[model samples]
Target: MSTTTQNRLESRYAGITLEGYPHALSAWFIVALRFVMGGMILFAGLGKLAFVSGEPFDASGFLVHGVDPASPVSGLYAAMASNVALMEIINVVVPITQVLIGVALITGAFVRLAALGGAMQMAMFYLGGWEGQWLAAFDSTLIYALVFLALGAFAAGRIAGLDRYIEQIDVGGEPLVERFPTLRYLLG
Candidate 1:
């Protein structure tokens, strides 16, 4: 290819600069973080669903006292715990969300939305653990949430994925994307 064409191709494949972000090292680092964190979330969520077959569980009795039906967020947990089938389904859905977020971050497709979703899932997971008074169990979920928040806030996918293409089409930037700039990283 001609030098011009080669350069163009390089820019396209390696990543095109945008507002001084694309190709930034931190962007790639965030991508790697998303990949690892996403996988971990997917694994844990799937494990929760799979626990029934491997071990005995009474979702109703999973958490009591401070986090039980009497606690502040008891209604929410009750809603979740009440539906054993739904909770089980959440297992499949949770991992699927993780897998998709991982794929999006790695491939740079719909990155902002994917990352936001992952963060929300992580927050929920963390809350679940917290309510149960299990900080050790909450740590991983909290970490995943922070990673996703970073990926979303920084638009890491622009470095080498479909996020760039999405940006060109003016579809990636949303209200949530704009809002991310203001949110501090508490989970990381």
Candidate 2:
């Protein structure tokens, strides 16, 4: 191509050099989303953690708070509400899983694993009882779930996080993959 043509192309596109982001500055937007989502997930876990302070968070509230006729999953949640053993187990699992997922997402270590877990959690919330008007577009929980899944699919963490460094390391005795084979699916 001629220098003039190349210059024109560069000028037209300006800073944005990647797909999905229109402007050069917009590429960071992806990482920014990851940060925001990670922070929220982390805080959410803390909010449910009992020893932190005040009243302990109880997962049973998920079922108790809603008896809405419109919610199709209300019956399932109601059934869970009756089982003390299950509720107790869920109460413990929810916070722990959320914390793990949050930490993974924040550090961009095993991002795909974190995102997949986040997606599952959000999907549960959406199905259990996310009160919203969108029957077609999707509610906040579902949106977050999709976001998590998308991040995983793209390995969005490699953008500006520790996952990039983790991808580079290797030892003679055992490759990173050999030590943690499942990480192959989780980290990108």
Candidate 3:
């Protein structure tokens, strides 16, 4: 090698670094992906649980058909209209989910599980988007969901977080992790 190349390589530890400065581009993407989606979920959960208003939603009226007061689930938004208490509880839980998942992403703990949950939540939200309902308001969330699934597929957690710890447990080569091929790429 040339003197300049040799000197540069030596200075850079032969380009070896655990900071994921190189060769782990996808891993870093996953981390960012988790943060963005987690934030949205957290916000949504908190918002729904916190808000309380008796007036029927203009959007809800558009999503569901006419209602018969006698029928609990019918009439525009009758389902939601009847479940004020449940909605409040959901609001609280949703925020908690957002905060916890956000922590997991930021700290790199159980990242796969957190990503999976994030993906599922995104799918549910995306699917629930009907007839220009709140779905349209948050249609962009679908992209985040797809990103989480990709992160899970690549085992982003192992590269960045507690996956290393999980892998250390002796279960005959960690059968649970072994079942997940992405575990192979996880940091050990």
Q: What is the lDDT of candidate 3?
A: 0.55
For model 2 the local lDDT of residue 69 reads 45
Models ranked on lDDT: 2, 1, 3
Per-residue lDDT of 80-141 in model 1, one digit per residue for the tens? Answer: 76787876766466656766766666566777777788888767656655645543544776
Tens digit of per-residue lDDT, candidate 3, span 55-147 = 322323422443333333344345563566755555455556766666666556676677777777666545444334443545655777877
User: How much is the lDDT of residue 4 in candidate 3?
Assistant: 27
- Name the weakest run of 10 consecutive residues (lDDT summed) in model 3: 1-10
Model 2 CA lDDT for position 134: 63
Question: Model 1 TM-score?
Answer: 0.56
Q: What CA root-mean-square deviation does each model show from the true structure?
A: 10.3, 7.1, 11.0
State which candidate, 1 or 3, has the greater lDDT.
1
lDDT of 3 at 15: 69
lDDT of each: 0.58, 0.77, 0.55
TM-score of 3: 0.53
